[model samples]
Target chain A: MTRSVPVRVHRDLARAITAIENGYASFGDTLATLPARENGKASFVVGVTGPPGAGKSTLVDRLIEKFRAGGETVAVIAVDPSSPFTHGAVLGDRVRMQRHSGDTGVFIRSMASRESGGGLAPTTHDATALAAHAGFDVILVETVGVGQVELEIVAVADVVAVVTVPALGDSVQTIKAGLTEIADLFVVNMADRPGASRTALDLKHMVRESGRDVAVLQTIASEGTGIDDVMVALTAARASESSNAGRAVRFEVVRNIRDAAVRRALAVLDAPRGRSVLERLRAGELTRLEAREELLVYALAEVINAD
Target chain B: MPIKVLVAKPGLDGHDRGAKIVARALRDAGMEVVYTGLHQTPEMIVTAAVQEDVDVIGVSILSGAHMTVFPRIMKLLEERGVDDICVIGGGVIQENDVPKLKVLGVREIFDADATTQNLIDGIERVVAEFGRARKRTGAATPAS
Candidate 1:
């Protein structure tokens, strides 16, 4: 690990970081070079997901403001849809979160979808690590949790808060749909609306039916209402499950082991013969099962030769 | 090895699934991605870029900070003598701002609707262009 990398490497690194910053898919060698921060040093990973126009972004802004007010630094990762055709991310979702426009304590990243799929994105994990290393106390992840995507924040966050509003459309035919049980806390924002109380009542009824121990709270992020209680409930949840954060310590260990194995395999298998085998697989001369078996044998033989 | 790229989030724009997916896509495409995490000031992104010596710098921003932040990166790299680096940006950029970004030395500007293939193509195109320039000018191609 040299302090001064070659200038071309610098150029490549710059282009890669700029790619992610601008919502494009960056190279993976770029991600691998991100030095891993020490384990168990993770911040409080909290997720906020809800329907479109449910004021999820506003609520996230409120939470981040509060945390920073308490002298806590915050990191926010907002995930938006990518252009399937162009494979780039048009991350307009981050515009709604202008409340913390200039605050130094808040680090917001708008992720554009272009390259990959499924779960909280890997760059999000890297951002979490970077924030932890920078000594942020909390990381707030907000996803476009609409359209049947079951909780992208759940895997990434220690606590997941599902934001829901009253009259979430299509209630005429069905009762249970959208961000329901996956929410650790059910927030009924826009509490200023007329049916707000009724919506809370209905939500309570639904929660009772679902048999999940979710805390339901009321909030009007526009007017700054009931956020304290939401925080209290969230703090209570974290206080109850300090062990979940502890699990990240174990997660990092597994990641390290996987990395070691992959590197070992790559180092041994980087030969002319090994590459020809891959070409055979790509050409469909070998089935994937056969290819895997062959690679295992090849990898072991290569390792022995290198030794 | 596929070309290495680093994606960074500077200022305050907390939205990352797209960056992660792109990183994964590049990985699947046989390239390596090093994500610098979020809240990167221009200095951190540039420092990491120089240290990692990546083939590309992919910056993702949606916070309207692009106008102020992206240019700052260009300036920083210029000061650090790494202006040959290919810079690209994608996110909720206005249709009008594309030219300004290019004028600022950003090689490509993809909007929110771009697919992974477009990004991979952009990286290759930009990298190849730089490779040609390096060859013509007798500058070294980036060493692995």
Candidate 2:
């Protein structure tokens, strides 16, 4: 690739975001400069995720309105699934919040979940950091919300709200197995619809049975009902910082190291040895466990040696 | 980086089937499409483009107001000094109006009958051209 003249970005918010997006050489230095807590307030990150068509966007739209009403500046990072072939994604989350379009108090950015496991874009943490550094009081990271495996939001978000709808098969098992453990709040959105209460009740029962104190809230996001309650719950979650601070810190640190290694590991996995291991497994010459062990050893050695 | 296109339906066009179709097509073609939901004005579209930092602004107008809408959008882009962003139009346009719309700074006007492939190809070409121009001028590349 030919090198072009460097373009200067004036605003720190834009500069940090562009640097992370482009993976510029200065990204690490730029990230290091951002203050963890700005303006005496540790910026709160709230993650809203659930299966697709669960009204996550609408829920986020309402949450933004509520946050803004409380005199808080809000920044939204909507993570959408990327196309496997071209690594592109349709970022339509802003369409749901058109009323907030020209409002200077709110900033909405749509991000593609580019090659990152757990339904988050690799740049999500950097973007949230920028939003915090720019003095946004509340930063909402909305996940791709594809399925169970997209639980990476918990690693970055201070509060993780899983928004689920009625009629998703075996809701109890799905929630109990995956979403239950990580969710700071479980929301049964579109609560006005049929069977909404049933879903909420089931979730409430599951929460009780699991021995965790996570809140289960019901919401009709389009109508803007139950939004205030959700906000109140999130405020409480944010206030109880000491409880989750250690976990959050560990998550951030481990992810910071793992993210860089994962990118390189992926590159190695696409190389010749990785292909041969996969072919062996497919041909029944090697068991899945054996192939995984071998590939892990090779990739781990490569990463460790590089360091 | 994927190309970002803002699909705006300007005016009181309640019919958004075309806009939705085109937005999905652009997404399927490996480009990000920001659909400014229906009933947008020229000002709203331009403001969206500026905020979203899109490379292409595609206006879907079926309210027979292309002549008024396209010029106003172009004027807003000029006023903001964001003339580098490519403009395209579609929906309920008369055959002869294409020339006038083009004169008003619309790079290409696709008719309602234009296939999704045609829209995709036209957008890719325009976005590529705009990118080259931006690079030559050293403008900060639009966010993908």
Candidate 3:
């Protein structure tokens, strides 16, 4: 009922998001039609990730309030893990951000890590672009906090804000979850709790040892402490460097291309000729690798022709 | 994509074991379930449901405040004009109270003894019906 106004103005933005999430057949091409870099005001993407229960959601809640107060429209994409088996996700991120529900300046979408090769959902990049097209100034990407294995946000966000909490074991080992490098800024959430200062110091030391000049800030996100500092650090980082700038754009392009290719490959696999190849593989008439190679060769040719 | 459901425990229901279980069941059944942690007001739940664009809301309340809680949630949804969202209640509800809850616009009520499969099937049926009804009325999406 509280329609994010930009979505109303852009008209197609909401429909485009629905199209992407619903897996409309033309979403691959729809990505091409979207405004990529150099075509519109580039929206800043901040990726927030860390261990589960580290208050990433609460941090995001505060960030939304701060960003909204600063007169900047915000969009949030909370990426939750889809069941590896059922492909369904409990996207509880919006629950943590109930404050922004009626704020027309903020738009929130919960996405399942569906079908995408990376930790993010297949439509995440497209969703971000839709938000950008809808005129959101700041975009926040919240990952499912999977350690090490889920660094896909690295390729998507311009600035990655890694969050951690106190008493979360050795700070260095915590950073070992592959966050040691991708973090443009580190936040020690729940700083109101004991050991917060120690955790912050450990993060500072680990960041220094990693040779990344990232700022480590402490925030009691539950009570909105240090949100302004986090905002300042994020803004400074966005202006200071282009760590994942061109990378996010290029990755999106290639991802869309790859997704299109996969869809085409699936279509080919459902064909009679492809079915014969599958039958051969099933009967051991051809090795799995050999059949895969043949399918790839056929699918690639078809993809090129389609292009 | 599967239908998205927001499972909320509005009010002071600290005992969210049933809510959590229902959320997990919905997820396992391939529905996206957003479980709002513990304490929440009707406003918070409705706000979250709208923001998440959920097709169904599975509210679990065992605090014996269903008479007040269910109506408030229904009123909030009505005020927000988000009638497309199917409301399904589950918890310790007296059998005689079922008609009252239904009159308040809850699509269905599930007792504590309801099976996981029953909840899933009921949610799916209501959501499917809502989708069809929306499609018929050209209300596939909420009004902007």
Candidate of highest TM-score:
2
| TM (B chain), model 2 | 0.90
What 10-residue stretch in candidate 1 chain B is worst by lDDT? B135-144
Task: Give the DockQ (2 decimals) of all models.
Answer: 0.10, 0.31, 0.33
TM-score, B chain alone, candidates in order = 0.88, 0.90, 0.90
For model 2 the TM-score comes to 0.84
Residue A71 deviation, candidate 3, in Å? 4.2
Off by over 4 Å in 1: A1-41, A98-101, A114-119, A169-178, A242-307, B1-144
Instruction: Categorize the docking of model 3.
Output: acceptable
Better of 2 and 3 by lDDT: 3
What is candidate 3's DockQ? 0.33
lDDT tens digits, residues A1-307, model 2?
2111111111335445645765652555665544443457777899999988899999999998888878888878888888888766777887898887656677777777877877788888878877776678888999986677666777778889999887565554645576667788989888888888788878888888878888989888999899889988999998885355666787777777787667666777799998899899999999999997888888788888889
Please give, for residues A1-307, the per-residue lDDT of candidate 1 as tens digits: 1111234333443334444443354334345433333344557888888776888777887888677767766767776555455443334444455445445455566554334343345455555544454445687887754655444455567887878777665332124654464667889898887777777777677777777677878899877798888889778877785434544456556554554555666765587766877899999999989877787787767557767
Q: Once superposed on the true structure, which residue ranges of model 3 sit more than 4 Å away at CA?
A: A1-16, A24-43, A69-71, A99-106, A133-135, A154-156, A164-181, A188-213, A218-228, A240-243, B132-144
Please give each candidate's TM-score: 0.53, 0.84, 0.81
TM-score of 1: 0.53
Ranking by DockQ: 3, 2, 1
Off-target runs (Cα >4 Å) in candidate 2 are A1-19, A22-40, A167-171, A253-261, A269-293, B78-83, B94-100, B136-144
Query: Between the candidate structures 1 and 3, which one is better when assessed by lDDT?
Result: 3
